[model samples]
Target: MKRDAKNLTNAAALAVFWLAGLTTVVVLGAVIGYVLVNGVGEIGLEFIFTNPHGVNAEGGIWPTIVATLYVTGLAMLIVTPVAVLAAVYLAEYAVQGRLVRTIRFAADTLASVPSIVMGLFGLALFVESMGFGFSVISGALALSFLMLPIVMRTTEEAIRAVPKYIRWGSYGLGASKWQTVSRVVLPAAASRIITGIILSAGRAVGETAVVIFTMGTMINLPVLPTDPGRSMTVHLYQLAMEGINMPAAFGTALLLMAMVLAFNLSARWLLRRNRRMQG
Candidate 1:
């Protein structure tokens, strides 16, 4: 009954896999459900549109929302070019050498480092050394550092996933190195690259520790380059950390989740549009 035993073993493994998958889904659903239930009730039009007021009576999240947008936008602006170029070099230009290996190792190590450590590094470098003094720019720079490894790795993967045939076709057409990459391979791989960027953007939006260290915790809506700002994450952290304000904190957490969910949905829609266009 050797064949019967093998089949039974396989069946047992399948059952375990199914159970594990189900458990994960259930746990995730429960968490999201709880957050939504608690947070949705507190969200309002004013909360969504108004800026954070220093006085508790007047505070809305508008300014925090604006600041969050600014920080995340600036971070993306700074990192996108650098990350894309680095990815291109690693994937297209760099030969298998010591430097390339070193870069790969560095990227992996950076990605694995805990985010709070990155915050501490940013605090030392941007806040202390450069005397950015806890402004939006400093916060944005910190986020850019956090985002670089993720974007670079994803971009490298996307480039690698491009079919060699496409590269060969471009080369056969007498395209130069950059031309082949820009024309055939990059266009073919753009959707995946965008997806990676969107994923990283989500991470940036939710990040608290780096923002907290570099951006500061003042609840006031900050001015542009000269002033400090509180991101939604920072706001949520304040609310959550205050033991007396559980309801407000929960509500803010829910709102943050909603914003993240909205961004994710938008990204998915864009991804689908790109795929359809590509097809």
Candidate 2:
């Protein structure tokens, strides 16, 4: 009787688990379908490529898209080298000691800080002290702060994912530690590392709070650095907050999602190609 009771309980738990899983799938599918249908319903080629002009809910988002690309590009440029180096040092050369622990703690703290706080820091440092005056550079730097932790964490994981035997084999070949890391281990982990960086790019592109405080809220397609660039995220935030431009805001959101999807898909394709070539 006890054995039979246990079997019944086990079967009940399995049924509940299956039901919960199906519920999750249904909820996610409904949300995604709703957004895609409403958001993609009114977008046209001209709306995407033309610059936003009047503020009376008749503007395009091309300038916003351009600004998003510029700021995200600048952030990636600043983040990639530093994040990769930090990951390399931590994975290949760091002696597991107090210093390593401190660094790890610091990284964790930075990662946990809110995006709005990072924006405030940028407002203080870049906008006030550096005299950047809310330009794309300032916004990019703000985004860099937000992205650095993600890039470093992901890159560290990628580097650590490399097989131990690969490092041993390189050492057996009389390669120096740096050579093994730079030429062998990193190359092996390149696809994953690049994927992490691209993921950070997507985050940077979609960010709103940080850019709003640091990048200023100008709508013109400014000429980068010297002038303010209005990112798509900022535009969406404004539109959504204004409460009367829901359709346009949804459309902008859809475009942003499409951009992120395109980037992720392209990155995956490239990674696959690289893996095939390596194999």
Candidate 3:
């Protein structure tokens, strides 16, 4: 009787897990399919590859695309090194105690802060106080803050997940601590680190409020880091909300989605290649 009861409970738990996973897939599929259907028609050489025209800015999304790339690229570049170093220090060097706990707690709290709140903070610190004005640099600084905690946390986890036997082998080979970390551990964790970066970038690329608050809505190609520019998310929001161009809005959103999906797929491919090579 007890055996039969255990089997029944296990079956029920399995069913619930399967149902939850299926629901997630269905919802994501539906959203992606709907966006592709609505915006696929507007994607073309001219629409994607040209710049805005006239006072109302009706043309292509070239400037916004450029701006989006600038912000995402710059933000990632700014945070990736520091995040890796910080994670390495915490995970590999630091003795676990109150200080490590406090550091982790601070990062977790920063990560939980709302993006809009971060935007406001950026507006005051970078845009106003620092006199950077509304530009790619200001937006990138704000977005970097958002990405740092996530990247650092993931990197630490990845480093910790490395097999202890591997570390032991490195020590047996007479490698110094720094040499072991730089040559073996970091290389091992590289795939996971890249994955974290890609995930943070995916979220940052579509950040509208931060862009609007820090980077001005200038519908032109950003020639310099200090030049004010508009991102694709802000463009989509204005087009949809202001009723300037609904179709363009859909197209812009679709393109943003596609860019993210493509990057994710590419990252997966790279990871697979690395794994196969290692094998």
Candidate 4:
């Protein structure tokens, strides 16, 4: 009787898990399908290549695209090194005491803070205080702060996942602490570190509020880091909110999604290549 009860409970749990998975698939499929169907028709060479014309009612999102790439790239550049280094320190060097705990707690707290709140903070610090004055650099700095905690935590986890045996082996081979960490452990965790970076990039790509607060809605190509610009997300929001260009907004959304997918695929490819070269 107990055996039969156990089997029944397992079956029920399996059914619930399957249902949840199916539901998630259905929902995601529905959203992607709808966006592609509506947006694909609006995409073209001109739509992508040319700048907006006639009060942004018509033309392409070239400037916005450029701005988006600039912000994402600069933000990644700022966050990657800092986060990775911080994670390495936390995982390998820092004594597991109040300081470590406090840092972890701060990261967790920052991660939980809402994006809009972060945007406001960024406005005050980067835009107003730093006198960046509504620019790509300001937006990139804001996004770096938003993504730092995520990248740091993910990197810490990846570093911690490296086997103790590997570290011991390195040490046995006369490698110093820094050498062991840099040459052995980091290479092992390269794929996961890249994955974390990709996740952060995705967040940077989709963020609107932070960009709006730091990078003012300047619909032009930013010639300098300090030049104000509008990201693709900001463009989409402006277009949709003004109710002037629904088609363009949908198209921009599709492009943003495609950019994110491309980033993920590229990161995966890089990881595979790195593994192959390492092997």
Candidate 5:
């Protein structure tokens, strides 16, 4: 009777798991299908290449597209090295004590802070305090702040996932601590580290509040990092909220989705290639 009860419970759990997974898949498929169906008709070379006239009513999202790329690229450039190094220190070198615990707690706390709050902080620190005055650099810095905690946590977890035996073997081979970490462990954890970076990139791309607070709503191509600009997300919000152009907003949304999808797919393909080569 006990064995039969256990079997029934297991079956019930398996059914629940399948139901949850199917629900998630169905919801995601529905969203993507809706966006594509609504926006595909508006996507064209001219729509993509031309500059917007009067708040995205007459032309393409060329300027906002460029600004989005600029902000995301700059944020990644600033955050990647710092987060990776911090993760390495925490995972490989830090002593297990109050300092490490505090740092970890801080990262978790920062990760949970709302993006709107981060935008406010960015406005105060980067725009007002630093006198950056609504520019690409200010927006990028804000995004870096938003992405840093996520990247750091993921990288630390990835680094910790590397087997201790690998480190011991490297030490046995007379490799220094730095050598073992950089040459052996980091390589082993490269895939996960890249995945973290991809996640950070996605967040940077989609962020609206922080970008608006720092970057401003200048719907023009930025010639320099100091130039005020609008990203795709910012443009989409402006279009939808201000009732300027809904069709163009949908088109921009589709483009943003496509860009993110392309990036993820490309990164995955590269990771697979690297793994096959390593194998």
Candidate 6:
């Protein structure tokens, strides 16, 4: 009787888990299918290349695309080096103690903070106090705050994942700490670091609140970093909210999803290629 009860419980648990997985997959498919169905007909080369011109601004999103790229690129430039260096220090140089724990804890706390609050902070500090105004620079700075902790945490985890034996082996070869980190440790952690970067980049690309609050809704091309601009997310939000153009909004959403998906896949492919080459 006990054995039979155990088998029943096991079967019930398996069925529940299977149902949950199936539900998740079905929901994801529904969302993707909806977007693709609504947006595919609206996507075209002309819609992507030219500036918005017609009534209700129902033209292409060229300037917004450029601004999004500029903002995301600048944020990456600002955050990547600093986050990586911080991760290296925490993972390699710092003694595992209260201070290290505090830093990690602080990073976690900061990451948990609401993104709208970060946007407001950026509005106060970068846009007004720093006199950047509604510009790409302000947006990039604002977005960097969001990306920093993500990159740092992921990188530190990746670096710590490297085996202690590898470092000891490097030291066995009379290599300095910096030499081992630069030659052995970093190479091993590179793929995971790239994955972190890609994750942060995907977040950066889709950010609307921070970009909208900092960059302002300027359809003009961002010729300079200080120039005010609009990103795709902001444009999509405006279109959807104001009921200006539903088709264009759907197209923007689809394109945004595609950009993130393509970037993610490409980064993973590169990591796989690197692994194979190293092997």
| Candidate 6 residue pairs in clash (backbone atoms < 3 Å) | none
Judging by lDDT against the true structure, name the best candidate: 4
Identify the runs in model 1 with alpha carbons over 4 angstroms from their true place: 1-17, 52-59, 272-279
> Tens-digit lDDT track for model 4 on 1-279?
999999999999999999999999999999999989989989999999999999756989999999999998999999999999999999999999999999999999999889899899999999999899999999999999999999999999989988999999999999999999999999899888998899889888999999999999989899899999999999999899999899999999999999988888887787788769767
Candidate 6 on 1-279: residue-level lDDT in tens?
Answer: 999999999999999999999999999899889999999888999889989987688779999999999999999999999999999999999999999999999999988888899999999999999999999999999999999999999999989988999999999999999999999999999988988888889889998989989999979999899999999999999888999999999999999999988778977887788779767
lDDT string for model 5 (124-209, tens) is 99999999989999999999999999999999998998889989999999999999999999999988898889877987898999
Cα TM-score per model: 0.88, 0.90, 0.90, 0.90, 0.89, 0.93
Which of 2 and 5 is the better model by TM-score? 2
Find the 10 residues in a row with the least total lDDT in model 4.
270-279
Order of candidate numbers by lDDT, starting with the best: 4, 6, 3, 5, 2, 1
Please report, as a residue range, the 10-residue window in candidate 3 with the lowest summed lDDT: 51-60
Candidates 3 and 5, the one with greater lDDT: 3
Q: Which stretches of candidate 4 lie over 4 Å from their true place?
A: 1-19, 268-279
How many angstroms is residue 39 displaced in model 5 relative to the true structure, after the best TM-score fit?
A: 1.0
Off by over 4 Å in 2: 1-11, 267-279
Per-residue lDDT tens digits for candidate 1, residues 1-279, read 999999999999999999999999999899999987877776789767766544342436777777888888889999889999999999999997999999989988988888898899889999999999888888989999888999999899989988898799889989999999988877877877877777788889899999998988766667676478888888777766655355556667777777788778877887799879867
C-alpha lDDT score of every prediction, in listed order: 0.83, 0.87, 0.92, 0.93, 0.91, 0.92
In order, what is each prediction's RMSD in angstroms? 2.8, 2.3, 3.1, 2.9, 3.1, 2.1
lDDT winner between candidates 1 and 3: 3
TM-score result, candidate 5: 0.89
Candidate 2 local distance difference test against the native = 0.87
At residue 260, candidate 2 shows an lDDT of 86
